[model samples]
Target chain A: MKTETKAVDIDRDKGDFAYPEVHVRDAGRGLSEKTIHYISDVKEDPDWVREFRLRGLKTFLEKPLPTHWASKDLEAIDFDKIRYYLSPGTGAKRSWEEVPDDIKRTFERLGIPEQERKFLAGVEAQFDSEAVYSNIKKAVGEQGVIFVGSTEGLKNHPEIFRKWFGKVIPIGDNKFSALNSAVFSGGSFIYVPPGVKVKHPLQAYFRINAESFGQFERTLIIADEGSEVTYMEGCTAPKFETVALHSAVVELVALKGAKLQYITVQNWSSNVFNLVTKRGLAHEDAEIKWIDCNIGSRLTMKYPGVVLKGRKSRGEVLSIALANNGQHQDTGAKMIHAADETTSNIISKSISIGTGRATYRGLVHVPKHLKHCKNNTECDALLINATSRTDTYPAITVRGTGNSVQHEASVSQVSAEQIFYMQQRGLTEAQAMSLSVNGFVNDLVRQFPMEYSVELKRLIELEMEGSVG
Target chain B: MNELRVENLHVAIGDQQIVRGLSLAVPRGEVHAVMGPNGSGKSTLAKVMAGHPDYHVTKGKITMDSEDLLALEPDDRARKGLFLAFQYPSEVPGVTIANFLRAALQSRLPEGEEMEATEYYAKLYEKMELLGMDRSFTSRAVNEGFSGGEKKRTEILQLAMLEPKYAVLDETDSGLDIDALKTVAHGVNSLRGSKIGILLITHYQRILNYIVPDHVHVMVQGRIVRSGGKELALELEERGYDWARAGADEPVLTR
Candidate 1:
């Protein structure tokens, strides 16, 4: 028997996930050492944070550009041409009402305030380099839930933050993470008290409205023993003629008997390079789940992950990525089973239309002596046009015996007969293609938070339009 | 009177002619059964009728209610009221039965017209009950991992839901047991009426018992050579088609 809970799951934010109608005065100067130092001097960060940025800036200068995958996209981002920073709103607001008019208008267009008022336990809106508005509901605050920007978390809870920061993903984990660690500004910091089950979700919004800018945010969530929390992060960059950079680092910690879910829906215009690092740690009997959907961006490289550090832990990554013209969504998940009796399931679905390409690059590693572990992975890609391309490169490393790992990958065109069958039922070829595509990702789409799922379907529909015609 | 008529239809794949000038007609409200040998283009005819796009309709015209079915795109032909219940229904991963049917039905509406979700589900449940299908089946992917009988039953369910002007059911009883055959045939039998015409293709005579046909045809080498009543199925079932083909393959005066 199945327990079905039905609530309105459609029209998930009719306008919620769209790029903010942000007005920018690109009427500005370019990045320089002076502006860099000015930025360091403005935030009033600790001496160590300043030195860290200076060192990172030097590394960012000396390090060669990424030469491996997605090199063409990496070449498009011109650092000297980028502005590096912008302050649309000066300081964080204790309440969303205190946010400025223009930024407030932006969120109003993106449906953040209403979403926060209606559903979320808390909401964080990061304007340019810092979160301008952050407020938690009284009931959630009563539960001792810590929700704020990562900058604040580092400033206030340095003892707890420093120990875990850069631990899972070190400074030089890759070229971009190192860039993020150097100049990271706003993101989110969440802590669920022990035994506290936050029923409502907490969400953060990241918007980059300036041209030739870099928005690096860092988010961390630590769900304590026996706690549960669902955190969501969404990003939208303005439609710019020049390339912008948005590199983020998200770390999640699920302690013993705890559950932590990290969800992201990124829709940057085709002029942005969205490279991000997201990973979580799951302790004994803990669970970590990542539901990621990538719709827009010139190129995106993110793989939300989970490390099973405790026995009997569970990890899952469900994703749906739609790539249209001029987009390359190279995203998937990672699962590492360090302890025994851990189980992991990864389902990745992608649709490539026009000249777009969607790649599923994932990893599942079960170390030696990990008895009774199970890993199942299934990746399916649908090529909507002859020119479109899709690929799946899943690395499943099972080191020890007594473990079962199953991996299946397939790339196929729609059956001409299936299209005809649906068309015969009165749908046009485009409608049939849309129906088939929807069905292709229905299993993974169902895993999204209801509202998000609806929005996802609509976004896919828009992405597929005119492909068949 | 409206009709789904195949006129001297010939279908070929590459150089091989799978269907050879076969002719048949199913007027509205009647059910015709074409029982053929292992292949004899039974499934091929069903696919070509559904506009499978794999075979070339080298020499044929499929018309529904006086409309040239072959002249239209496959999906266009379908929207104009032609449906094919596949013998091997493709398992559409991730798409639920309810959603697929909804898209099909929604496509039938006039532009800008919307369907009422509540009423659609109510009618869907009623049709599901008639087919003896569990309501939970609506949430399952279309034919994904279904049993033989379940797949056939799903075809029939789609037939009923679509309410097409004409339906070409290809090998609808191949994998089903007797019980499933009865249930599936019952569903088909219940849908037979003035608004819909059915052309049932089968390899075995077993299904004809439950779904009695108004006319029965014997197909051999992609051509239908004999037309008779229900008794012909028994003749072919008991005597087989080779003798029938032998009866017709007489050497004519060298002309």
Candidate 2:
């Protein structure tokens, strides 16, 4: 019931400011065996993890960028120019007071603490290569749910962490995944106990504060049998003159009869390249849903996927991407039906403003042996200017009898008459355009949580400003 | 000066002229009907008054009260107490009626000022009730998937909610049945007061039977050829538009 006027008060430049870096440890510039060894030595990683890092580095060095189907803008990235790791050299703090003063101010400016106090059951805030603060409500933690940094999860719960680490998205899955595996740090690791449903969402906030840096955070979430949980993550980076890189890998596992929803809202600076790999595995009668919103970034390449591995498993992805001037948002979803009677749905909406470009690349597969599997996919694009561009590529392979698949795609522009109609009702040009854009993605945005949905609408309005003359 | 006045308005779309040397005025507290045949430039006048970008006002002046309406943007003109209810309202997909009206009202407020949600919904519900609209209609997308009668009713609902000094309703009775026409006329009549003026544009005189105008003007070839009291509408309804076209060459008899 919040009024639209009140929501417009959100500061559009909240993510444009940066503070000086205060890191005690630095992995130095460039990606090499020496850099990986420095990161491993600093974290005091075990021999297995150190060897895993070496193998990931090897794969990263051998693989080539997937330029055949991706934008040639990928050729502009310089791996040797980025600082792979920079940490404040402090372990994840349990109290907000223990966080560094400058880091606390950063999260405070972003309104993280207030949000945690309001609705979040637990929160983990990451600045650069390490999590500065991590906490969970005592009442929720008493229910046997474990939420902690990935490093702590590796050290404290290796039995649960090691079994699924790199099992869903292996190091060689893609070039960016391989690069992330080589030097990943500071993402959330969560596990909901069997039959103990988490009542509230667990959130993680990632901030990259340094210049000429690369952030590679790896996240993993596993919902046990008959349990339900929702995890949300948000990311932002300060505007830097030089190019930065953000490559992340996220894996989700939903056990028998479990439901897990993962939501992400990332607003990076225009000077950053965002390349990420996210996928989930659903067991018998389990459900996995992904709600992703990508707003900024010079070039973003992401396609969150799901593998329906057990009978009657369900998967759904609802995505919203906005590409303003001088940016490209390349995003979509994937569904692989490996079991009988599995169902999946993918709905994606994108907006391209000015000369920005958006692309949707999707894949849905059902083998000949599978029976009665169904899949539905819809992708819609909105172009706000004459120069705006969008593209769609959907590959669906359904070979089995009685299996069905449906695909719908559309590309449309805001007509001049529509704007005039809105204007005659007392809306300015920019307000009219923003309202139209919000309406275009309204259904998908409703999938987000209440707070995030409001924030998303405000962000869309901010982007629409100055889009019309 | 206390009127929505157009002085020798000349309008065109690209190379073609639509409204040529048209002049009219509707004073506050009066309902004026402009009866015209198809392609007689009635809708063009409505569009020009609303500042539609496609229409260029080559030579003319549109004023509300003593202020120049042609000098402002469409949204600014609307905020300054001018409204245009289109014959074919655009279908803005996924934007519910409640949100659309809220945004429109919000734009009229000064910066940093917020609209009171309770008062807004109360007024909105009252207006919708006045227009014979269901309460559930607030959540539906504007004009999308709406029946012909429903669209006209929604237009009246908006006209009631955003109370302007002057309203130009173009073909509001075009796609309406007799019952819907009566309902829409009732809504319009309820809003007629000393503070508002109305200019109802239509092709037929059927709607005039329900909501009688104080004055009637017959238009031919983008110019008002005749003007009179309410009897003029009855005369036209009886004789048809051929009688108006026959007198296009004669000087206008303004009353």
- Which runs of model 2 end up more than 4 angstroms from their true locations? A1-22, A89-137, A206-214, A235-243, B251-255
- Who wins the DockQ comparison? 2
**Per-residue lDDT tens digits of candidate 2, residues A169-239?**
99999999999999988777888999988987876642222111236888889999999999888743222
Indicate which candidate wins on lDDT: 2
Candidate 2 displacement at residue A191 in angstroms: 1.1
Docking class of 1: medium
Q: Which ranges in model 1 have alpha carbons more than 4 Å from their true place? A: A1-33, A69-72, A89-135, A155-163, A206-214, A235-243, A310-314, A336-344, A365-376, A395-406, B235-243, B246-255
Residue pairs with backbone atoms closer than 3 Å in model 1 (clashes): A424-B78
- DockQ list for all candidates: 0.55, 0.89
DockQ for model 2?
0.89
- How does model 2 fare in lDDT? 0.84
What would the per-residue lDDT of candidate 2 be over residues B1-255, giving only the tens digit for each residue? 799998888898998888878888999999999999999999999999999999999998889997999999999999989999899999999899999999999988998799999999999999988888999999999999999999989888899989999999999999898989999999999999998999999999999998889999988888898889889999999998999888888738452
TM-score of chain B of 1: 0.95
